[model samples]
Target: MEKKNALTAFAALSQPTRLDVFRLLVQVGEAGMSAGEIAAALDVRQNTLSANLSVLLHAGLVRNLREGRSIRYFADTEGLRGLLGYLLRDCCGGRPEICDPLIEDIACHARPTPLDKIGQYPTPEDHT
Candidate 1:
């Protein structure tokens, strides 16, 4: 992420409500959650939640899509990953060992099982 992008994301996360909303979206994943659902889940007023969502949206941390009478919000994972990468790009300098454990944890947590596959599988030959 560029410095400006990182600043924007950081600014958005600086707010308590926006942070809560962003964390909620992250938990929801790609399918996301509707605005009403978010408000209800957080016990936040609709107007307050709306303002928070707007900040996250402006920061490119969340995206909104019209879903019937409601608007659904999803975490912009690419933007988030970019921000995280930018923060960690030079971490631990050349040693790498410090960040290696974090990288391993991320990989372990993100590893997909058969049930997590979103599409069809390929043969072993396709790995090459």
Candidate 2:
């Protein structure tokens, strides 16, 4: 991704509500949630959720599809992947080992497992 696009993605994620919404959408995958569902899940008011969704949509970090009379929101994986690639393109001085754990963390988060009190997540070492 270009610098401007990366900045936009980062800005969109900087907010707490937007971040939560994005993470939730990512977890749900292509089976996205409607605005009402997201609002209920996040315990947020409709107005607040609408504003957050609008910002995310403008940043290209989120996309929506019409489901009858409702719209379902989803994470824009292409945009997110581009942003992630841009961030890690020059990370850790070209050492893949240094980035392995980080990738594992992301993979862990992508699944729908409950986190423990210690916030321990499955790592590459866990399966070894």
Candidate 3:
């Protein structure tokens, strides 16, 4: 992402509501949530949520699709990747080993596990 675009995204997330909205959408993954659902989950008024969603949309951190009369929102993964890439473009000043652990941590979350296919997470028993 360009510097300006990153700044806009950062500014959008600087707000508590927008940050929460983005995190919720990311958690849901491809199965996005409608505006009503988001409002209810966050316990935010529709009007207030609408404004925050708009800000996130403009900042390229979130995207929405029309679903009948309602709109379903999702985290824009490409935009997120761009911002993350920008941040790590010069990571560790060319000493990759220093950034290896951090990169691994982020990459681990990027990949979906078997439990994701069933829309569930592994329990302690599953791990054993």
Instruction: Compare the candidates by TM-score and give the number of the best one.
Output: 3
Each prediction's Cα lDDT score? Answer: 0.80, 0.82, 0.82
Candidate 1: lDDT of 24? Answer: 84
TM-score between candidate 1 and the true structure = 0.80
Q: Give one digit per residue, the lDDT tens place, for model 3 in 1-128.
A: 38999999999999999999999998898788889999999999999999898888878888787767788888888889988888789889899999998878766455447455565321111100
lDDT of 1 by residue, 1-128 (tens): 38998999999999988898898888767778888999998899999888888878778788777766888788887778988989988789778889888888876366458576584221111100
The parts of candidate 2 lying over 4 Å away from their true place are: 108-128
RMSD of 2: 10.4
Model 1, residue 81: distance off in Å is 0.7
Clashes of each: 0, 0, 0
The worst-scoring run of ten residues by lDDT in candidate 3 lies at 119-128
> What CA RMSD would candidate 1 show?
8.2
Please give the TM-score that candidate 3 achieves against the real structure.
0.82
| Candidate 1 vs candidate 3, lDDT winner | 3
**Per-candidate alpha-carbon RMSD to the true structure:** 8.2, 10.4, 9.1
